[model samples]
Target: MSVRDLLVLGSASAVPTKARNHNGYLLRWDGHGLLFDPGEGTQRQMTYAGVSATDVTWICVTHFHGDHCLGVPGIVQRIARDGVEHPVDAVFPASGAAYWARLRHASAFRDTGVIRERPVSGERMPLDTGDAPFRLVARRLSHPVEAYGYRLEEPDGVTMLSGELAARGVRGPLVRRLQQDGRVTAPDGRTVTLEECGVTRPGQKVAFVMDTRLCDGVRELADGVDMLVIESTYLDEDAALAAEYGHLTAAQAARVAADAGVRHLVLTHFSERYRAEDEPRFAAEAAKAFDGEITLVHDLDRIAMPRRRTSGGGA
Candidate 1:
């Protein structure tokens, strides 16, 4: 069976508290595992999350910040140690090439050649994944440093309606042919098009917006996505601090989700200043704006992607 979920390995901001680690997130989509913003202790956190280095197909770094990319050394070494034969793509800002090189070879174990470097440079460039099921694009975010947010969008396809197929006497190989060719001849000598038997199913979209203030890039990434995992580093009261630090408050994150029609909003990368007891306050403030599903993540938390929207409903 296909699995799509977000595994929170670490959820702290710049500093790590006793309750929260640094920043790390693993997004399992189908057969691809996208590890995002892996900070310190990510290898250990992966062990706790029941994921291994081999499970990671892509390592997406938003910036060169220590809290975001510090774990690259350990993760790369682990992947080499574990003999991960598959090519692992590393996506980050092109300007941080030196930082990525340092971390990638920081005391390398065996130094496998399987790690493919895909440093993004432009404002809205799509990472080349060949024939992957989804298109991965990076957009520049408003941060103190060179930062980029990632968005995965599956192409829209058609879902064959069994009832419609049966009504048209389309069955067996004809159904497959109709899907592939967009039209097929039935046994009754009738030609049926794909639109006649299938409904347009909107593709699933997910965005990762981390270490960014309120910017157009954030909105573009969050637009019409099914799930949005964003950085909510501060509460509403600390809006000034959030702005100064190039981070988002819970209210700001929630308002973005509401405006972009995000079905599931995951608020993470919280500052260590907030206690565990203050977590609910984040949800409460976010609820005032976004009415959809909201999750305030912690270490080792697993959040499944929302179900696909029905036909005619926007993704």
Candidate 2:
């Protein structure tokens, strides 16, 4: 069985509190594991979550903030120590190349992992994930420092309907021929088209938005996505402070998700100022704007992706 889920390793904004660690998120999609914004103590957090370094295939950094990328050294070293054989791609702002290099080499432990560096420098760019079914896109975000958000989109495909196949009297080689040639001669001497036997399976999408104020890129990344993981570093009461520090309030994040038609909204990267008792306020404010499922993320929390959308059309 294939597994797909979002693993929340750390959920703190500027700094980690006693209960929360820094910002680290692992999105497990099929065979790929994309780690995002790993902050301090992320390695231990991964251990607690039962995620090994070998599981990570990509690392995405929103910016070079200490709270966001401080754990890169440990994670990179751990990857090397564990002898992760596959290539690990690291994506971040092009301007933060210096910071990434420093952290990647910080106390290196006999480097063995193949870490590819792909820096984002434009409005929107696609990262190379080899032959993965989904396309990885990055867009620039509005922040004091250069920041970016990521989106993963799967291509639409066709799903064979068993009932439709049976109705057409298509079986064995005829079904395969219909799929390959778009038309096949059935045993009854009737021609059957691929469209007659299959329904369009719209692909699923997931977006990650962190440490940015409201911007067009944020909505563009979140539009029509199945799940959106975003930063809600502050409450509505601190809206001005949030804007000043390049962060989003729970209400703002919720509004973005609502406008973009996101099926699931995950709000994280909370400030230490909000105590455990105050967590519900964030959810309440977000609920006011977004009617979809909203999750207030905590350390080690896991969220599964929703089912794929079904449609009647071409692949």
TM-score of 2: 0.95
Candidate whose TM-score is highest: 1
| Candidate 2 lDDT, 62-163, residue by residue in tens | 999899999999999999989899999999899999999899888837986499999999999988778876899999999999999999998878889999
lDDT of 1 by residue, 1-315 (tens): 889999999999999999899999999988999999999999999999899999999999999999999999999999999999999999999999999989998883778999999999978998898877889999999999999999999888899999999999999998889989999988899989999999989889999999988999999999999999999999999999999989999999999999999999999999989988899999999999999999999899999988898898754
TM-score of each: 0.98, 0.95
lDDT, candidate 1, at 2: 86
Best by lDDT: 1
Q: Candidates' lDDT values, in order?
A: 0.94, 0.92
Candidate 1 global Cα RMSD: 1.1
Model 1, 309: alpha-carbon shift in Å?
A: 0.4
